[model samples]
Each structure stands twice: as C-alpha cells, then as structure tokens.
Target: MSTTQPQHRSVIDAITAPRDSRVAFSVEFMPPRDDAAEQRMWDAASTFHDLGAAFASVTYGAGGTTRERTGRIARRLSQHPLTTLVHLTLVEHSAAQLESILKDYASLGLTNLLALRGDPPGDPLGEWVPTEGGLNYAIDLIRLTKSIEECRDFTIGVASFPEGHYRAENLEADTHWTLEKLRAGAEFSITQMFFDVEHFLRLRDRLAAADPVHGVKPVIPGLMPITSLRSARRQVELSGSSLPSSLERRLRSAKTDEHVRAVGIEVTSEMAERLIDEGVEDLHFMTMNFARATQEVLHNLGMAPKWQAAA
Candidate 1:
C-alpha cells in the first residue's frame, strides 16, 4: 500500500521570501543525552514555536557518534510546526551507510540537511582521518547526495567560518573551501558561531569580493548567546574562534548566574541589532537546548514573533 508523503520547505526559499520584518531568525538544537534533556529540548521547541524561526536544525555529535540519537530527534521534531533540518557528517561511516541514512531521511520527509565533515571524537582538535570508502570533505558528501535521485531533491547546506576554520592556512583559503562546497551543490551556508559582529561582516564582504559569481550563497550568521563566560570561552576555543575581549571582560565582571545571563542577553541583543541594521536576512541562534536567552534577545530587538509561512 502506498501513502502520501508530507511536503517540505526549502531554506533557500525560506530565507529569500518576503517578510513583514526585514530580518528573520532560526535555531539550532543539539541531540539530547537523556530523557530529561529530551524533555528540555521539546520544551524549548514549544517555547520557540511562536518565535518564528525560519527553520530548526539538529546538530550531530563529534565523529557522527550521535547518529542514531540525532535521527530520532529529527524524527520527533518533524511533527512540530517548525521545519527540522538534519545534520549529516562523514566522520566514521562508509559510503553505503551514508546512503542508507540519506534514504531514511527522505522517507521521513526531512529533506533539508546540513553537510559537515565533523570533528574528531576523542579530541576535537585531534587530527582527522577519513574512513575507507567514506567521503573526505563536506563537498564530497554534497556531490554524492545530489547524485542520488531520491536525495537529489534534498536541500543541502554546509558550514562556514568567519574567522577561518583552524585547519585552513588563511582566511582566503577558508573562503575558497566554502566556495567549493557551495559550487558542489550546497544550496546555502551557515557560519560557525562567533561573538564579534565584525567577523561576520568581514566574512560576508569577503565572499562577495572574492567570487562575484559562484561564491555567494544565502549565508546565515550563527550566534550563541553567552550564558556563562567560562562555557562560552571553551566553546569558542573549540570552534577555533576568539571571544571579543571587551565582551569577555563584561562577562567576567558579572557576579551571579542571573547577572551573567542578563549580560548575555544584552550583548546578544546588541549584536543582533547591529546585524539587522546591516541588512542581514537571517540570524541563527545556537540555543544550548534553552529558550530564555534567545527569547529575551529577540524581545530586546523588538522582534514580534509570528508563525512564518515556510517558503
């Protein structure tokens, strides 16, 4: 017996669609580790439902270790109003396994994905070794996914670094790699999280100035509202980006958790405001499975959330 499939929306079209507000926002959530965490994620999803995120993306664990859990989360969230995007990484799996996962995603009507090469599991900074018969880079995965007819209709996106991925020789080379991924059939790109708005501005300018033709993609700036100075510092370190010293000092001087969260909301709001004023189409928040800070940031920016129609 055959059943009807659920219709999905395109993020490329979502970002480009007309809106009452010039700026739009999206969210990123990590796979929950336990039942309690799972509940929290769902709660966050429900809270942000009215916040009008263009789409919600689920992140994969290092080396694709959380593959099963990530898939389950995506499946659970598929029932929600928000469009869920799954993340695919070629860290330790073979080509056959990757293909099967892609087919499964198609079956579930999750047609949007973020292609990533992933970080080494044990030590994120450790050397990366591509598995036998598996793809080596995100570009390879994008090409392979698009080659499969069933997956050909999927909207593939890749990661970019405003301050340059640590593995790259320089910012120029980093830009080259991002362009290559887009050229390989990635419909759009979202940046790694950064504290400084200037880095994002420079990256945007760099992409446009570097390649007039193929390099430009709908780039969504990824941001994490800093809840804890210590946690934020560590995350930035792992992502190979630096936290602005001025913001760092401000976080350090905050005495209590409440004050720290308030600082985070304030700084995040200011940065987001700057981005909106600069005419960015979308802002992506790396919500650490929580909704308060992101909600506050949107509020501070006078963002009136709506259930935006997905394009």
Candidate 2:
C-alpha cells in the first residue's frame, strides 16, 4: 500500500530548535520486571517530566513478557502532556494481534510507537517467530502497521544501529536493512546505544551518501551512561556497542557506587555536550530503570528542570 507521510510535527524539529543547535535530548525508559523495579519506572517518568524531555519512550521486554506493563506505562506517561513513544515487537504476533494493539493504543490516546523485531528468547538470539499471523521483522511490522487507518495517527519510529546490528554481516547489510524500514513506512528511528560519537557520525554520513528517498529517517543517537562495571559489560554484550578505554578505566578504578556514578555522569555529560556541539539531531538516554543518574547527567548539562523554563 502507498501511504503518504503523516502530517505530525517531525521529531527533528524538536531536536533542532534554534536555541539548541546541539543534539536534542530524549530518554528511553523501560518497564521494570518486578514491582520494585516498576516503582522505579514511575519515578523515572516523573524525572523525565522534570527534565523537559524532548520525548520519552517505553521498551518491550526480552520476549515481550512485559507487554502489558509496556502498554500501561505508555498510556500513563502519554497522559502527562509530554511526548510518549512505546516500543513494540512483531516476532510473535499475528496481523490480528497487531491490529488489536493498534486499536487499543488509539483508544488510550497514545499516538507514537517504536517498531522493533525485539530480542529473541532462545540460544541463538534473533530466533524470531511469526506467531502464526505476526510479522517476522521490523520492516514487515511497519508495513502491517500502516495498513490500518488508526495507524495514520501513530508516529511510527524504528530502531537503527550505529555499530551495526549484531545479525548484520557488515555495515552495508545494516544500511540496506534500515533503508527497507523507511520504505516500509517508519517515520524516524532511534539507534541502539553507542559510546563512540564517531560511529554515529560515520553512519549518518553513510546514510546521507546513500540518499534514499525517506533518507535514513531521523537517526537519533542512543546514549547510555556507564553506571556500573557489570552494567556496562552487559550492555556491550547485548548491543555490541564498543566501550572506550577511558570509560573502562574509570569503571575499573571505581570503589563505590558513588564513585562509579560520579565518573559516569562526568563522562556521559561530556559526551552529551559534545554530541550537541557536533550537530547531532537528538540524544536518546537509555535508563536501565533508574532516574538519579539520568537526572544527574541532564542537570550537569543545564537541561534539567526543563519545565521551569517552560513555566
């Protein structure tokens, strides 16, 4: 089906406001797996509100195990008069199931979504399932989403990879996959986390050179502050994003949570600042269910208490 681009305000517009030529900052908050973690989700949401987040997103769990929580948080947060983007997976859903989800979100007044193929549950990761009726990949899901009328109101976003998706053999393959998503109807994209700014810049340049019609979507860069040595390692293992030696050295030398967090915030805030100065389009913070660190990073950058400026 040929779907024209919807008339919603582009995410790029929010990021490139004249006052901030630097990268526009947004946060990606995932729903907690347990009640305690879930409470942290609410606190994070409130903190996001205070940060005057350019946009806020909720993530689906490893196997879509937290779908309900993802939906609930998306609904609750979208009510805050802030931009809310919910993540979804198509690996195990049928077309009927997806339609139901689209309709449910429309009823809840949620209008933005991030379509993901999602991480798999088995030994070989990306071991996706078509769910008898669901989509096999994100591009297929995006195409399915656009087939519905309610989807016209949804600002559909897709995931991108700067270091390249683990499944991709190389950069060229990853670029082809991303372009397919845009042609399928994704309006914009938020990347997986990467520590090196150069990786992002190079990917952006490649996209520009490729010059596809939709032309690489928005390509927002994802930023994850180093909170703990183990946390950093886990992220690297999961996303294949590289870690810089400076960051590794600080994490290795830390003696306490306070020390680690301090080093992390210092390093991350500098990265954020540099990203802005480099003309990055947006900053997507990956909060692994915590607010204090994300808050510290934003505060250090003079962007927190964003509501105060609006007030």
- Report, for all candidates in order, the number of backbone clashes: 0, 5
On TM-score, the leading prediction is 1
- Colliding residue pairs in candidate 1: none
Provide C-alpha RMSD values for all models, in order. Answer: 4.5, 5.7
Candidate 1 residue-wise lDDT, 86-158, digit = tens:
8988878898888998998888888998999988767778899988998888988898899888899999899
| Residue range 1-311, candidate 2, lDDT tens digits | 11222223435555555554234677887777878888877667666655556777788754454766776676666565456677888655677877898888777766678888777656425554567766778887787778788877577889888888888999998988888887777878888888877888888777767865676467888888777778888888777677888778877898898798778878888888887787767788998867767777777878664223213
Model 2 lDDT, residue 264, Cα: 80
**TM-score of candidate 2 against the unseen true structure:** 0.86
Candidate 2 achieves a global lDDT of 0.73
TM-score of each model, in listed order: 0.92, 0.86
Candidate 1 has a TM-score of: 0.92
- Model 2 alpha-carbon drift over 4 Å, by segment: 1-23, 62-65, 122-126, 305-311
